[model samples]
Structure formats: structure tokens, C-alpha cells
Target: MSESKKILVPLLIALIIVSAFVSGCVDESSTSQSIQPQEEAVTEAETVTETTTEDVTEKETITVTDSLGRVVEVPKNPESVICSGAGGTRYLTYLQAQDKIVALDSTEDKVSVGKAYAIANSYFEGYPTFGQSGSENLEVIVSLDPQPEVIFTMYTTNGYDPDELQDKTGIPVIALKEGDMVQNREDMYQILRIMGEVMGKEDRAEEVISFMDATIADLNERTEDVSDAQKITCYAGGVGSAGSYDLMSTDSYYPPLYFINAKNVAYDPAAPKVAKVSKESILIWAPEVIFIELRPSQFEGENYAPYQLENDVSLNQLSAVQNEKVYGMLPYKFYSHNPDTALVDSYYTGTILYPDEFEDIVLEDKAAEIYGFLVCEGDVEKGMSVYETMLTISSTPVFTSLEFD
Candidate 1:
């Protein structure tokens, strides 16, 4: 965060009157920088809203530089918008601005209830599908009713260029970075602030940030005193990436392990964060415990890593497998990181690795607490209900010990 960026952000106030845009004097004022709307017009049959982005205007919009350093002008309190990436909607959920989302991206519409955020807010499925993550359907977008006032995209570099997308759709496009929960905390925090400014949820964004810092501190506080000799040697397998992977696919620097101070057997200071290792490597490392990423897709076939864990004779020889310490991890990546679930997994990991220190904690209640704050807007009953639904959907008790046939 440079001083210059801070200067641009303070100008993003929430008090801008949205009704001013309705009177029609500012017809071409949807975005500053004078970008024109797409030339391809939808026919009358497809025109849900006769007035497109070309007609949608705000009496006032503040200029804020996005994660990519593109200066975008968005309504101070945009009530109608489309979050343009799979994970972009996650931030809005944290901010309690789901009501602001007028339409869904392809992933949100198609894979409804697949992630913790989505499960907690299943009503999003009722919204019209706007576009896919990265690329959007410009025709459908420009024609939408309660027309989108701004476009917030998380994966800016994934597909359509933010500037080009704005130029084509005639809507302001705010690019956001999908920063990781670990290591990239600042990037993630910056995004929250940017969104908070746009949606007038500044205080809520800070609340989310404070919760993350305090929660991580509490996690470290619990196990920081554990000596190296007492640490549990662990490995996380079947780590999901671009495609399906078996047991050999893993991350040495898995974030949840760091939260609980689990010593990873595959950890190497110089190793790539993610890698595919040989079965022989696993035999030699012989981690005392192993965690596999649990996903609905993995349950579909015998070819996935979870299946390999049970069928592989050499793998069964490992101490962890013999001791029945193999566990299925709750879903971590849904399109991208769910900070809520990441914290939930961290607490669960602490309980498993340092049970005495985490003795007072109940995993289900902890998960509910996190979900309640992040998605359910402090509704514990709703959060707990969502958590129960997540568990049933996992096909097994993924957050706990597992049985393999």
C-alpha cells in the first residue's frame, strides 16, 4: 500500500445518492475515463433492460485504483453488480453485500452449494447467470435488468483484460487480486478494503481483517510453545490443483499445517510449494500422520487419491495408515481459498495435533462460529445449519477420521 494508493481510496465514500442516476441527465456517465460501450447490441427479444450500461449512469462515482493499478470509477454504494470470478463473490459474502449482487458468474450458478460460502448463501442460485469467471457474456450482461452498476473481477489476469472488458461492456470494471490466506495476507486485506470502499462496508471489512489476525494469533498462541521434539510429523496428500491428482500430489507448505505448527515430512526450505512426489519418497519420509483433501469429485471414482490410500499395499504399511490416523480434510479450495474454512481447518488441525491445548474446542461449534461471522452475518443457528449441510454433502465426515473400504 503506497501513500498514493491510500490517497485514491479515501475518496471512496458510501453516501453517494443512487437515485441521482435515475433522472437521466448523466446518461453516458457510467464510467469515467470516457470508455465506450460494446457495439454489438442485443435484439429487442433479448433486451431485458431497454437501457443498457450506455444508459446507466451515476451522478457521482469515485476513482480508486484497483489491485492491477487500473483507476476505475465505481458508484460509492453500488447496489447492483456482478462479481466476475468464482472467488470474487467470496469477498462480497464476507462483507454481507450478497444482496448487492444482481447476477451470478458461471461457476456460482453452475456449481451452487459446492463451497462453504455458496452453501451458506444458496439463494444466490436464484440470480441470473451473468458470465463465467474471467470471461463474461457481454450480450447478456449489458441486457440485464436492474443493470449491473460495476464489475468486480478477482482473477484479473485469467481471461478478459479489465480495461477491455470495461470498454466492451461500458461498465466500470474493478480488478481484484485473489490473494492467498497465508503469505499474501496484505494482498487479501487490500482487496477487502477496496471492496469495502466500493460497497460502503468499510467497517465490516476491517472486522473481517481483525478477526483473521486475531484468529491466526490465537492459533499460534495455542501451539507456539510446543517443542520441535513434540511436534507431529505430517503430510497433506491429494492436494487439489488445476486437475485431479492422487496421493502423490501434495504441498509442503500447506497453510493449515503452519497454523497448527505441524512438521511436514515433505517440507524442504527450497522445494516448490506444490509438487508431485514418488511413492518411494513417501515410504522414506513415513510421516506419522497424513491428511487428504476431501472433495465431492473424489467420491465419484476409484481412481482418485483417497481411493489409492486404501488400495495401495505399500502405502498401508506406513505408520499413520496402520494407526488409522489417515483423515479427510474439509474442502479448502472452492474456486479459490475460503478464509472461513481455512480457519476452521486450522482449529480442527490444532485439535488433532495438540489435543490438550485444544481440548476445550469442539470442531463443529468452532466451524459454526467461523461461518456465522463470515457468511451468515452473525447468525449462529444459520451458520450451524450450514455447517451440518456441508458435512452431509461431504459424503463422509471429512473433518474427522475416515474409513476406507
Candidate 2:
């Protein structure tokens, strides 16, 4: 309890502390180093976990087999895409996915009015164009703001190489066939399904397919009972393919004719799908009912074939010309064979070939219904307005040839 005892006790405590450090029993620096590594280990573990999660997010995608048979991995439910070839945009429009279109081919911007899908989505005129029809400008595709995730191209030919396109744009590209509404119906449906699968619209794809199926079935059933003897021999001429052609341009197997049970007088087992019939050949196999496509030139007063029919007295010798059986069908081959117009053409042809069966139908109403369901998702109000807009660009199917008024 004295001053000397207090000093001795403090000196003894200091020595004990120094001796513990000298013996390395409580090495503070070693303990500090050990705690630092544990902290770093926890930080490293967190960094690894964060990086793994990011990799999974970056790789999230779905695999699709395009019409070209190319397997591609695309981002799940891509919100933006480019429809790049002939009927590529049309198929997307048919699936009611027109909103997904980020850019279009310049051809659509130029020929916006005539193509049915183009007509339905006229606002597309304002969207950036990727390139010309059947050909895409990869530079523009890649430079698009908010870059597109996928590209749907049709008719892979005409200078469009899907593989090269996909490579250059770094965007997944899907190629498709311009399959017809008839014989190759399944191919067309399959293309829609593939796209729908990629876009997460599988149900919509099936809905569109079922509508087409029901349409084809309805057309066939309506004319099913027409006796082969009673079925009129008909011909479709002035058909558009690649570009406009003269009156003699026709397609054998002329898809819609088969659906309506018309014995196409031009139906050739050996001829190319599209053939140029001679004026002389026409005289020998005169078709009783003639359906014609009003080419774009015709609207511009070129009157390519119709001028020949009305003025070429030699052609007047044909029954179709003389009896007024020649009718104007919608330009079904705009861009590609427009399935909606094909069906409308078939129905109109049916009214002429067998009116009693189509007596309950109104052509305008039916046309609107077709456009509404196929292009507008069964929204007839929108379909009705679109139909009116369509009339400005295309002839209403029905009426003697060249009589759009």
C-alpha cells in the first residue's frame, strides 16, 4: 500500500507484457495479418458469386431451327426484331407481332401501299429501312438504335445469304420460305410456329394456323359438291411474279383454283408453275371464266393486259371476253402470294362459279373479316378501316376486268 510497493507492481506488469510479445505468444501483427486474409476471402467469394449470376443472365437464350434449317440461339422473347425478306414481315404481321418490327426493308417503304401487310401497318413507313427488298444492309441493321435482337428473312435467295447476314450483324437471323397457302401450307405454318416459339407467341402462332386451316377447309367444302362436269374451266392470267407481266402470264396449279374446285384450264402437269401462254394457245383452250390480277402498272394507267383485252379485237373472240366472265381478282402476288387476297379471290371466284353457295356472304364484309383476323387479331373494327385503306391501293375483288370503279 506504500509508494515503493505501487512503483514495483507497475514495473512488474510492463515487463510481463514485453515478455509475452518477445516470446511470440500474442503476436499482434500476425493476428492482424490472419484477420486481413479472412476478410479478403469473404470479399473474393462475393465477387465470384456476383460474376456467376451475371454470366447466367448474359447467356439466357432459346434455340430455334429456322426455315433454312439453321439452328440459332436467340434471346428469350426478343422485344425487337427486323423482318428482312419477301414475306418475312407479312408472317410477323400475320402473327400480330408487327409491333416487334424495329426496322423494315426499303422496298416496303417504297411499295408500302400495295402489299396488304404494308397497307395494314402504314406507320412502318416511318421506321428505318434495313435495305432493299430481298437484300439487307447489315450496316444499317447493326447501327439501329436499341439494336434489334433478331432478324426474320424470307426467300433467302435474291442476294440474301442468311449465314453471312447473321455473321455481320451479330444478330440472330431466321430464314423462311414464301410457302403458299395451298400445297405448302404446312411449311408456312411451321415458319410461323418457329417464329412464335422464338417470340413466346406459340399460342398466337397456332391461332393463326387454325384460321388458315379453317379458311382453306371452308373454301374446299363450299365447292366440294360441284360436279367435275359442272365445274367451269377457269384461268388466272396477268399474274404478277418477280415483276408485272402481260396478259399471257399465268400460273398453273394456281393454288386458289384448286380450293374453289375450278378446273383451271391452264393447269398443266408438265408446265412450270408460271408459264407464258401464247395467244394462239389461248384460242384453242378458251377458259370460260377468267380471273385477272390488277398489276401496279394497271393502276397507273399502263393497263398492260386489260388494254389488250378491251382493244385487241382478236382476244374478244374468247368467251370470257365476250360474255363478261373476266373478273378482276386482288393482286394476290404482291411482294409474295398474299394468302388473304388468295382466299378473298377464291371466295369472289366462287360467287361467279357458284353464286348460290356464296349467296349468304358479302364480299366487303368477308374481305374485312379476313384482314381483321389475319392482320388485326380478329379486331374487325381495325380490319374494316384497313379494308378501306386497302381499296385505295388494291382493287376490290369482283367486277369485270379493269373495272375497279
Candidate 3:
């Protein structure tokens, strides 16, 4: 073969190998470009899945029916809560679920003296104040660091709609019907039951109900046989509007009166639940026994009902004052009816009215038992101390006897 022919054949083979190598490189580059978009798409899909899962986790909720018959979606396990109206905090404290309370109404925080709950749960004093009772501050509530999951309030208040409140605060608002505790006890029970369900303290709620039931039954059994002639005509003074004090104010259906079967001079079918009667009417009624409901304001002032009764010229003529049948009782209706304190008042009223029926009872011991069961943390002695403190601060006679001449 010629030299030129040999060189041309080798060059052609080299050129063919180069062409194949370049084609392989081009194919690899195209493949890398195609795989990159697919990898990015997979990463984006994963990110979306994570975000959706987080949203679902954050939005978990459950349905509840409030006392006003409004259905609402609330947190499954509410970690933070606020009691927004009068006596609203009382319910939470009664349930022993005040640990979950993140904020309080201004009235609850502002009042230095009142109900055993406030005295017992000192921690509540430090909680942030959302607003005054019946008038919550929407901006302050929304600005809470760990936002409250729910808001509890009374159904009877005007201009406070649960739906509107929930919408404004982005929190569930539950309105409970807190009727007259003496006249409508079942309503109170229902309120407790609903609170128990919402607060995850159903068992504790049942325990309280049982205590109240047993106490009422025991009280009734002792006094059931007493004749109408034996029943003492009584009047509860200083039964002012919630959270205030007025000497002439009285309850038409005081629990102590109902429990002990006493005749309430203020009880009139036509009268409002709480009524203000004149001194002339009081003279006409001439109650045999008078119970002065000690108020917090009276603690610092000289206008306490007992002192007023003692000094009043017209009141001195009444049999209760003249015969010294006047007694002092812890304010049963401060903020609202304190069922526990009212129960304690019942025992005192019963013992005074029918000494023979309650001869075995001791007032301080009995008060301790009720307070321990209802308020104290299983410490009967502490309960007694709290009760004594209440009496002392209010300037009330702890255990005055009606048999005194």
C-alpha cells in the first residue's frame, strides 16, 4: 500500500472516534438538564406537604354548645382561658380549674376583697386584666402573648354576643346561664356540668355537686319537721347589686332562708329577685331574725350593716335589733351568689333558727368542712382560717346566738 493511503485511513478512524466522544458528551449534558427540573419539582412537593401538615396541626378544633344554645368551634384542649363577666371567675375557681386562666376581668382583679375563691386563689391577683366586667377590651385580649383559647361569660348580660365576641377576638366565647342559685339550683348544676366538660374537670364537678346535694339533704332532713310556727321570720340586709353594698338591699329568695325553711320578709311573688325596701316596710315586716351580709367595702368603712342596724333609731325598734337577734353573715351575693359561702350561711341560719335541731353542730367546724370541700385544697384548717378571716375583715359576728336575751 502507498504511504498516503495508510495515513488517510488512520486519520479517518481518529475522526470517527472523536465524533462518537462528542455525541456522548452532548447526550450526558442534555440528560443532566432534564433530571434537575424533576429533582426541583420533588423538593417543592415535599415542602408543600410539610406546610399543609403544619396548618392542619395548628387548626385542630372541636365543637361545643354554649348555654345560649349557640354551637361553636373551640380548641380541643384549651390551654388558656379568661372569665369575662360577673361571677364568671367564680365558676372557674369552683371547678379548681383556675390554673388555666390566663387573664381576668378588671373587676375581679381590682376588687381587693370578696368571695373565698379570690382569697383562696391568690395567683389570680397577678393575672393580666382584660377589661371591666361586662365590658372586655378587644385590643388587649388580642394582644395577649399566649392568646387565650376561650372566654367565659354570663348569658344574661346585655350587648355581649358570643358570636360577635368570638369573631372579634378569634377565640371561642361561651356564655353560661347563671340563674338564681337558690330558686334555680338545677340551672347552677347544668352550668357546672358544662364548665366541667369545657375545662376537662368533669370528675371534680361531680364531686362538688355531690357535696352540695348531701349538704342540702342533711339540712332539709334536720328541719323538715319544723312547724310554720317554729319557722323564724328573717330578713337578709346588705344584699346590694353585684359587687356593691347597700343597707336596704335584700334578696327575695336567699339560699339560707330557702335551706332552713325560714320566712323571708322580702319574699314577694311580685317583687324582683333583689329588692330595695324602705325602713317603714322593714318595720312592718318586723323580722324576728336579721342577717347582715358583710360587704368588702364595709371592711374599710364604718357603714357596715351590723353597725348601721345598731345605730339606726328606727331599726333599733325592730324586734331583731331590740331583742339582739341580729347576726352577721358572710356576703353570700358578692359579685354573685357564692354557693359554698351560702351553704355555710345556711348552717348558721339553721342552727340559730332551730337550736334544738342543730344541737350537735358546731359553726366553725362545719364552715371548715364546707370550705375544705368547696374551696380549700383539702386543708380543713386553712379553710377555717379563710372563713375566720372573711368574718374578721367584714366585722361580722362569727357565731351569734339567737337565744340571747
| lDDT by candidate, in order shown | 0.80, 0.78, 0.79
- Residues 287-356, candidate 1, lDDT per residue (tens digit)? 8888887777534456567778788888877888888888877667556667787788888888888899
TM-score of 1: 0.83
lDDT of 3 by residue, 257-324 (tens): 77777778888866777877787888898998888776554343445566567667887778887788
Candidate 3's displacement at residue 110, Å, is 2.9
TM per candidate? 0.83, 0.82, 0.81
Model 1 regions more than 4 Å off: 1-58, 297-299
Candidate 1 whole-model C-alpha lDDT, 0 to 1: 0.80
The lDDT leader among the candidates is 1
Give the worst 10-residue stretch by lDDT in candidate 2.
Answer: 396-405
Candidate 2 per-residue lDDT, tens place, 187-233, comes to: 88888899899888899999888888888889888888879897778
